[model samples]
Target: MPVKTENAEQLSRADREARGKDAQAVAPLESNAEFTPGPSRDPVGLLLEQEKTRVPELLPVRHGRMLVSPFTFYRGAALPMAADLATTPTSGLRVQLCGDAHLSNFGAFASPARRLVFDVNDFDETLPGPFEWDVKRLAASLAVAGRENGFTAKARRKIILAGAESYRTAMRAFAEQPFLAVWYAHLDVEDAIAQFRSQMKKKRVKATEKMVAKAHTEDSTKALRKLTTQANGQRRIISDPPLIEPVEQLFPDVRVDAIYKLLREVLGKYQRTLQSDRKHLLEQFTLVQVARKVVGVGSVGTRCWIALMDAGDGTEPLFLQPKEAQASALAAYCGRSPYASHGERVVAGQLLMQAESDIFLGWTHVTGPDGVDRDYYVRQLKDWKFSFPIEQMIPSGMAAYAQMCGWSLARAHARSGDRITLASYLGGSDQFAQAIADFAETYADQNDRDYAAFQAAAKDGRVQTTTDI
Candidate 1:
């Protein structure tokens, strides 16, 4: 089927509803075909190919992290999964997709309003794609995670269904609201806690409150205290080796002065991407140190650097992370991003899909020491951000968390997609939810197979890994 590119504003709400109903003729709501690896394609090869675009030395660390579990491998295998999702059935409605919208990708972060808000926190793989693609990926993640956690199949199915249902119901609610209202709708931490308290037992609610309190303390000041130290009357980033090492330590042959100059130039360019007020706020701090920090499974091999800055009086500290951005995993299937710079692409997508964003979010392009031009987006190192403890998740708790993830994702799509049409397509039924449940189960099986293949490759010396990066 040809992709649907019609703008939501081109049709009346009723007309959009009719258009959505037309979609069922192409693909039924409950039809979930199993994932079969393409006859000529190799999942392992696809993974190894992505490594070519990353810092070569860190590739082993990336593999090591992914080797931990099938769930972690899933996190790093967005490209392989995107290739498969392109072959699956879609609802034909596009959105600013969190292209790797797994359960862990949704988390709590402090918004510009200084309120802790819950939403999709990662955007490295973000792009425009069918809304169902995100929903399916999220559902499948829950299934994989449930298996890893040893939940019964029946219990996993319930969680998937609950998540799908939450998305459908939330989309329906957003569809009824005015466009501006839908654009502004957000779930702050306090609001999240209240909703959970009403539905959750006392024990879970207390645990949640404690988690929220901890997240609040994870701001820039806290990070500064933990990751920096005074060296010759200057605060410098403490090298923890492999995980958090100074750039000079990793690249001893390279001139440190040249790297610092290039970074300063890149930071200046990035400042122009921000709003006038944010740019002014940033000017108060001067850069003191920069360190390459390996972060996340999928992003482990990427050149992620943390820069520390301080006010002239040494009273205020600011931490900014300038992480490399590459072509989104979705770009190959959907289309090249409209923005020239991939960093700009990431920043633009985040601003569009998120109700509120980090005040310092911006992008820049730089030529690295390797002579390769790279794109990077910069933002505060930590702004009271934290994710829930998935290890402690019970079936019932997962069900609740899944619902929140679904609701959050739906709200994000509603802002950048046609919620009215999505609502009409879903149409107050369980068919779509059931379809997602089916897809989740099947995809979870596929993940297991892929993980086994990866493990075998590692054992045979086809892949390399270390205990810690």
Candidate 2:
């Protein structure tokens, strides 16, 4: 389970270059190849299998969300993509991957340093894999999303190619920097704005700024107002069945005192995983309420809970989300995680790839009344976070967004992989970019076919959906 690196430090730049060139023998460049569906491959069956581990009641909600469009379907279909990617060509260079590196997964969030930074925020499927796997997934997503945004097929190809080029150039830059400098590299909000301003229209710049302003308003205190209300002069989470409900309401059979006691024990264990200062800081808050909350399309069926805490002062609040962490979709294809719990696996991967992370980030195991053990990673909820709105995307806007994703992803890989080798393999040519563009186009077509199949399944009653909100 040791992380893969080529002992690349021993090689001179030229040697690394040669090694990169040698990779072409194993996997040729410029061949983005087609996907011929495997005779036994049933995408719907695969999705059904994934649902087995999810909360049974939420399965319909998950399916309903993914039914929105091909883009959303692509978002939730990471498992199938992982399977397909395993059959694709590789240069045999491995890195810690953001296994579901679709465009939507890149977003802006406040770092622990209190600076707004853009990075890959989702790590549910992260694992060690061929570096190209991430790039291909990203490229394909751009194509799918761009089509959804009404971009021409030709225009979408350009966006994918442009993103691949950005990744190649950014990786090369990181390869030349001092190791410590590369480790410290991060794209703060100002850096992000400046880059976008240089490459985008004024209108888009203003729009991005507006989005950033909106993100600043999302935090625990704000969440308290929206999701909680005073009960007997104390704050309690509001109950809205299906979407948000008290744990007691969801599990009516369980004693409320027992639920609180179990959570207190879990929180105590979670605190031990934090640094001393963070642990001390957490001691200031008192947990008051807990509720089950549904999250994103892909994450819908997972057991996610939000805790409301009083920050000692009556008016202030702290909210923490303990999201269930299952074994990564990439785990089976790559290898099992070395960490004892999937929660720990997620925490380790996030800390390694992000330049800055949640100060409260930690992991613990929780056993339900059924004697089932579930791993969860805890972090502050909605502490300044927002995603780019795909509805507003235009070809030019998409190109800029793609570049940002490419740059952010490269920085993540640089932190965990052999940078020099990766950059060298990318080379000083457009061959890689063109190849990825071709791959993106072909894979996007495959995604549409899968999405159609999904739609048909739902229509045929093979897939259930929940539309009631």
Which candidate comes out best when scored by TM-score? 2
lDDT of 2 at 434: 90
How many times do residue backbones clash in model 1?
0
Question: Once model 1 is optimally superposed onto the true structure by TM-score, how far is the C-alpha of residue 37 displaced, in angstroms?
Answer: 3.4
Model 1 alpha-carbon drift over 4 Å, by segment: 1-5
In order, the Cα lDDT scores of the candidates are: 0.87, 0.88
lDDT of 2 by residue, 170-226 (tens): 999999998899889888876778867877888888888888898999998899999
* Candidate 2 accuracy as TM-score: 0.97
Whole-model lDDT for model 2 versus the true structure? 0.88
Error of 1 at 16 (Å): 0.6
Instruction: Give the least accurate 10-residue stretch of model 2, judged by summed lDDT.
Output: 30-39
Q: Write the per-residue lDDT of candidate 1 for residues 1-469, one digit (tens) a residue.
A: 1123476777887898887798776667875444566777577888988888887878889899889999999999899899999888777788899899999998999988789999998999888888888998999999999998999999999999999999999999998999999988988877877976777778988989988899989987898889988888777889987889887787789888987887789899999999999999999889888999999999998999999888875558889999999999888898888888999888988888788899999999999787899999998889989998787898988998999999999999988888888888888888899988999999988898899898898888888877565
lDDT, residue 136, candidate 1:
87
CA displacement after TM-score superposition, residue 259 of candidate 2 (Å): 0.6
